[model samples]
Target: MSEPSLQHPLTGKRILVTQADAFMGPVLCEVLEEQGATVIASREDIADPDAPRRIVDQAGSVDILVANLAVPAPSSRVGDVSAGEWRDTFATMVDPLPRLMQAVLPGMREQGHGRVLVMGSASALRGMKRASTYSAARGAQMAWTQSVGVELAPENIQVNLIAQNFVDNPTYFPPEIQENPRFQERLKREVPLGRLVSAREDAQFAAYLCSDAASCFVGQVFPVCGGWVNR
Candidate 1:
């Protein structure tokens, strides 16, 4: 089948997307390019020690910044979690968002206009059983994005988040979980949509959030959950 086209409202804009090789990231890139936006792709693991420098080198100034890198926590009861696991999860999902935001803000402020979209999960809305770390980190990201949005609004920069639901992207589900029929059945029952959200749909929402049309949508955690969170 032919690849789907990206129709973006970001014409002539410069967009920087982190974790470009990941499923949603590439789709977003394609869409932005289709809309005439110049996209610079970066794959620095945001949790890595040199992530800031790496991202800066690849992206000097951007009209839009999409922070889309995250590490999903393993599903386990709270009592069964280990320190290292918790640290790793936080490193990817929570810690680096602020740092990356700092790195991008100076240029954005100088320009007096910018758009920032931080990717989050619908899991943050309702805590899932055996997903303590994931819930905590995603929740933190949502809050931080809102705080930044408020702080940056006076400068004409918009900051928001997309609290996505059960997307069908491969990265959304770990291999073992995808291979488990029992778990899959349970997921089907839990999501009222009766299926997972598509990556393209999520990407399209993201692209819109980064466009001029979303200028008034600051500090909001918009859901693209396909009715999952509403239930």
Candidate 2:
């Protein structure tokens, strides 16, 4: 195990954060930079099959890959889920995992140390109404992380995931939704924390996972949803 710096554990580390404009991408990049890491933020639309590889190629080598992939979750019930919607959801969230891994793994292997963190959703960890398509895609991400995390562990590349929900992000719980009384009641009733996990809090945890101190963690699905998954 390496002794990581307390204040700047990510110093000297070059990290690539995908979908830099959405989901947890913005905050993750901000916190990682504050931790002294060189963040290669990519805002590329990865729906095109070649985009993931292109993004990686453009960024060159990186010590970490933060797959911050997301889309506006579809709210169709299970019976109403259309094939196009299902495929699009997976295209955005699930398909890019392997593509990004394929692009980045070789460099990581050469370096003999790397980290991959997927900013996923707790909707996959727990059941949600009208979220079948989204949850299925997120579930695939978690399973892929578990499998690849172990496979790459021996090579010193740690792969893990943060299954998060009820986090303060513009995508899911924007200010307008947060200010609603009904949503506030739902938060109090459903979430054990009685509030959305702040963006900084979630980003800080992500920083830890990307740090040298987190090398031992592999194939782990860490829930950062204000205890919503457990409850």
Candidate 3:
């Protein structure tokens, strides 16, 4: 492993963070930059089949790829889940992933070292009401990560994901939800941690995963759900 600066775990690393303005993108980019990495932030929606390849081409060679893909969770009941809705969910969250991986691998393979971290959800790690579509999509993300992470392991490309929920983010748990009494009670009762994990806390963990120190953790799904999924 290379000697990294204690104050800058990612110093000299070039990282590409997709969906730069959403999910954990902003905070993730901030943390990576603070750790001295060159962050190419992309705010484009990758639902288009061609977008992933185009985005990866635009970013060129990066030491790390932060696939911060996300979309609003569908609240449609299982019985009423439309074909359009289900296809759209996978199109938005699952389809473009392989393109991005395929596009980035050639460069990573040449360099002999790279990292890919998916800022995914824990909804798939556990069950939830009215979240069948969301959970399935997230499950596909983790499953793909496992397969690709292993396939690319010998090439020195580490792939892993953070299966997270109950984290303080505008997307999943907004301020309004946090302020609601019922939601607060639910948080207290459901999450063993009894609170939402801060966005910074999650991003900090992501930074470590992108660093040289975390090279040994290939294809693993690290849960960061404050124990909500355990229940």
The best candidate by lDDT is: 2
Q: Write the per-residue lDDT of candidate 1 for residues 137-216, one digit (tens) a residue.
A: 88998999889889889899899999887775657765676668886786677777766677788887788788777799
Error of 1 at 162 (Å): 0.5
lDDT of 2 by residue, 1-231 (tens): 333478989888999999999998899999999998999999999888999999999999899999999999999989999999999989999999999999999999998888999999888877889999999999999999999999989999999999998999988888899999999998988888899999999999999999888889999999888775244
Q: What lDDT does candidate 3 reach at residue 217?
A: 91
* Clashing residue pairs for model 3: none
Model 3, range 175-231, lDDT digits (tens) per residue? 888999999999888988999999999999999999888999989999887886343
lDDT of 1: 0.79
Estimate the lDDT of model 2: 0.92
When 1 and 2 are scored with lDDT, the better candidate is 2
- Residues forming the 10-long window of minimal summed lDDT in candidate 1: 1-10
TM values, all candidates: 0.89, 0.96, 0.96
The worst-scoring run of ten residues by lDDT in candidate 2 lies at: 1-10
What TM-score does candidate 3 reach? Answer: 0.96
Clashing pairs in 1: none
